[model samples]
Target: MERTEKETTYQETRRVQKGDFAAAGQISASYKNMLKRLGVDSKVVRRLAIASYEAEINLAIHTLGGSMTIIVYPDHIFLVVEDTGPGIADIALAMQEGYSTAPEEVRMLGFGAGMGLPNMKRCSDTFEITSELGSGTTIRMGFNLLN
Candidate 1:
């Protein structure tokens, strides 16, 4: 059930640097702007914004580095994020709402409250995360364009 090129309406990719405070919300903001420009429904855009922001923060605060890409289809939107290294060991535990591996430094910044993954999952119609402890993590989230 993968989308073909002919079905994609638009796509964009952004690089995320680890601990890049200045670029923290750039990815999500860019995506949100694009959707708004495209006249996508507010509910879908809001869901995507929330999930993408959490995904962006997780990439910046948790991984060494990563890239996030968004693909827009007529009836669906897909987000694929891949990070460099220092991956998660337990996907199940990480999915827990209050569970987090973020350090005190990140928490002090008013983030890393252990809600990233859960928020992503909650906001998306489909969510999948795969991580290898020493390698990296990949998260794919899909949203339906109900509007």
Candidate 2:
């Protein structure tokens, strides 16, 4: 099944709280379930799950608060993550694998390996992140449903 980019559709939106380690990935899990229920392709679902989880974790672990929105079209799934926290000073540096500013405690908890942005970019068909020094960050990711 092939779909054109013009066939985009709005799906759902979810809010994420900061310092919610206990509930990390909850939004992605629910989004995955929703996609599954909609009969979306497994591969697309997998990619969305991975990307969404990474974005969610970044918000919880790094930001003060944020939200995740899922927009589904006939051909693709779009994810927009916006947060209100200390923004990335260097997006290029942040994108490097194994480069993280996560605190020691976060690393000890098995996260902040500097893979969040890289992993998100890897899993999405299109990915973009913008941040200010002290304001916050916003990430937009798109996953193709028709491969």
Candidate 3:
């Protein structure tokens, strides 16, 4: 099931940089702040943080650049990330546990284990992704506080 969303709430936006590993953690922090301000508990906040961060880094490492948007409501938080990169040609394969298209340097840094999509799916109550081979990719992650 998807997180229940309200028509109005606090929102935040962040710009993700291409190949900027150093800035990878910023999205998670921003999500956490949004959650806190909305009076969400720490446990649920942590789950949302993990999912949001993974999605953010996936954009940074795989795509040229993108933006992360967080929407916080009373019941849950929603994260949307859009990137301009070579779309996943085989999404099914890319979702596998050990499949990744990350470069050798990224692998050496222990970043891409083919777990970004899986982790995002695991952490969010409802996850959605859409992409095209030559266009871009967009990921939507939702975490429910009621769970």
**What TM-scores do the predictions have?**
0.95, 0.91, 0.89
Q: What ranking emerges by TM-score with the best candidate at the front?
A: 1, 2, 3
In model 1, where is the ten-residue run with the lowest total lDDT? 18-27
Q: Which ranges in model 1 have alpha carbons more than 4 Å from their true place?
A: none
Which is the leading candidate under TM-score? 1
Whole-model lDDT values for every prediction: 0.90, 0.87, 0.82
Please give, for residues 1-147, the per-residue lDDT of candidate 2 as tens digits.
144546756566777888888898888999989899989999889988998998888889999898998888877788999998789988999999999988988888889999989999999999989999788999999887777
User: What C-alpha lDDT, on a 0 to 100 scale, does residue 37 get in candidate 2?
Assistant: 91
Write one digit per residue (lDDT tens) for candidate 3, span 5-78: 45547777888988888789887887788677778988888888888878877877899898898877666677
Q: By how many angstroms RMSD does model 1 differ from the true structure?
A: 1.2
- Tell me how candidate 2 scores on lDDT: 0.87
RMSD per prediction, one decimal? 1.2, 3.2, 2.5
Shift of residue 106 alpha carbon in model 1, Å: 1.5
